[model samples]
Target: MAASSAVEPTSFDPSKAYKEWEVNGKYFGDGREVALLDYIYNHPDIEQLRGNPEKILRAIDAFAQSVTGLINIGENKGVIVSDVIAQHKPEVVLELGGYIGFSAIMFGSAMKRAGGKQYYSVEKSPLFAAVATSLIDLAGLRDTVRVVVGTGAEGIQRLYDNGLLRSQIGMAFFDHHKPSYTADLKLCERLGLIGKGTVLVADNMILPGNPPYVEWVRASVEDKRAMDKAAQEKGNPNLQYNSRFVKSFEPSGMEDALEITECLGIEGA
Candidate 1:
């Protein structure tokens, strides 16, 4: 494990909690996703939701609150990343997970407003991607947000091979399989998809921490080189990073954190 980057935790208001997620077995993919689509389309304000990102987000939140909990960034941590998009003004952004397009609609709208060109969301499940695509279209962000159905590595490879990601990615958000974080990031680094000025934001850092990822990003070039000798997923050891931790809450009112790192360019480049 790496030395932890610390931040003050924000107090959560219990009154704002969503319907708790499944306790025993499944938390997602048991028809609730399609139910979300039905809920949104059947919403009385469906007409008003069209072309309105914020309203669409509100509707999603409504469903999560009254219906069932959703695994999403939600408003709290979402605002934190949204602020980063506004400040950094990334030209193109890549997202490892697209679950239901909540973050896509939220962050995609922000990116478009900031004059960004593209937002690619890679989702592993075709069913999940379908739901996300429908919602993204409903949000009128079809042009800016493109959902790719594949695992993180596969999607990155496809995009890069197709020339869609010919240049370095401006920013990347990791919220997929907890174990895939370091591997997918290494894939990006190996493919030159990340470089100087690229911003990396990883979710679920506290809820279920990712130690290897945190250590890699915060490590010095020399340290990383030594670490890579035993690593199967070899990343660019010389890519310098400055990282920090940010404390925020989940929609379910549970505590979580995001590891935010910025590439400072390759050492001695």
Candidate 2:
């Protein structure tokens, strides 16, 4: 009989290649995102804190768990939205969808880093609001970030009632239902929540595209161009309008992930 060679052990370490596998798998692989988020939430360093630290850590954990565990686990749109807010260092932030406060934490963290900023998240789901409120309290951001339970439109009225609209809102994030994006934008405009140089970011623009809203923006840009042309024809001052779409894709193994589209509103134009 021929001598049999010793079989080498398979070196398939899940943790070592987890990220590669995750991206290749297209953001869907046995709840990997959820597991990772849970790990972060339940980390020992975050758990062992006392007083404010402990509360903040708990809020962070709750928020992560609420989004990844309860809502769609593959929804990683928060990354892009959070990154934009963090980079801009906005003084005031308004988020459309609170969703267990995951995005709220990201915004709050960004605001904290930027210094002297506050975030107000509006969530329609009462359950999510409850969870988020608890998490916000735990995260010790009760002073910096406020979670309001209601849609943006409804919350706008409440904000006015509470005298919160006086502060200039620098950034706005839209992550609620796709159909509500345009409506919410209009609502914000009517309520004067967005200023001239305000930054408005909409997530999932491609995967779950909002055709009406997208078309509206296109038409508005065309109208602005026409206005500028008409002004030039009449020897009147031509004001230029700026509009651009930023395309961002979340790295996930799944084919359908998150897409972030940002639109900047020029005040005087």
Candidate 3:
């Protein structure tokens, strides 16, 4: 499949900038996440945020902007994924990362709005998962989004083995460990969870780009077959993908991209 680039120039609004998250050689996991819960619950308008997804999102954004920096898929990049959800209307959405439940609440609400069913958010850190669970429940998305704590591969396997992911996933979002992106995707393919109509949206493509994953998705079936011969983590080589690069900005106003890929079909099916 041919690669395409959709560029929409966006300038970060200085007024909306979040507090510098990086401090004294630390980015996250310095008790800030738990503090975020306290901040949200104690917000003067806390009642206004309850059961309101957008409002809760605003509250989270407020905390990030005024209190501390959060490693999240900010509203800017979030719109791109939401647009994809609106168009595709995936019934079951799988998110590889559920950091503090930002994307889970955002995308889970989007999925529900688009007539989708379940949204499974797999988070690696239990503490992060707990934080995400609370926020997601606050957004009134507990029924739509389910958080499973484990690494990408482990979570995928658990879901699949338990029949929660027995069929192909409608959409899968990758925002976990960068190195696990390709391997986890391969596992999905091998398990028959990535078939025609599957939409894969991978974040952090520009800040810390993933060349290997990009190359794998954009490769021709013939090229992929060649790659699988030597690859330890083998995916379905016959799967065809039309991948593209979408230029957007992070919530922090930093330039970033989401590699959006749509599986066309099996090559010989």
TM for every model, in the order presented, reads 0.97, 0.64, 0.98
Ranking by lDDT: 3, 1, 2
Q: Give the C-alpha miss distance for residue 95 in model 2, angstroms.
A: 0.6
Root-mean-square deviation of every model = 1.7, 13.1, 0.9
**Candidate 2: residue 80 Cα off by (Å):** 2.9
Local error of candidate 3 at residue 44 (angstroms): 1.4
lDDT of 3: 0.92
Of 2 and 3, the candidate ranking higher by lDDT: 3
Which candidate should be chosen as best, given TM-score against the real structure? Answer: 3
Q: Compute the lDDT of residue 179 as modeled in candidate 2.
A: 82
- RMSD in Å for model 3: 0.9
List model 1 lDDT by residue over 129-233, tens digit each: 999999999999999999999999999999999999988988999999999999999999999988999999999998899998898998989999999998888
Q: Sort the predicted structures by TM-score, highest score first.
A: 3, 1, 2
Error of model 2, residue 245, in angstroms: 4.1
Tens digits of per-residue lDDT, candidate 3, 1-269, equal: 64767777577787877778797888889999999999998989988898999998889999899888999998888988999999999999999989899999999999999999999999999999999999999888999999999999999999999999988989999999999999999999999999999999999998899999999999999999999999999999899999989988877777899999999989889
In order, candidate lDDTs are: 0.92, 0.56, 0.92
Q: Candidate 2 lDDT, tens digit per residue, 175-213?
A: 787888777766665566655456666666556667755
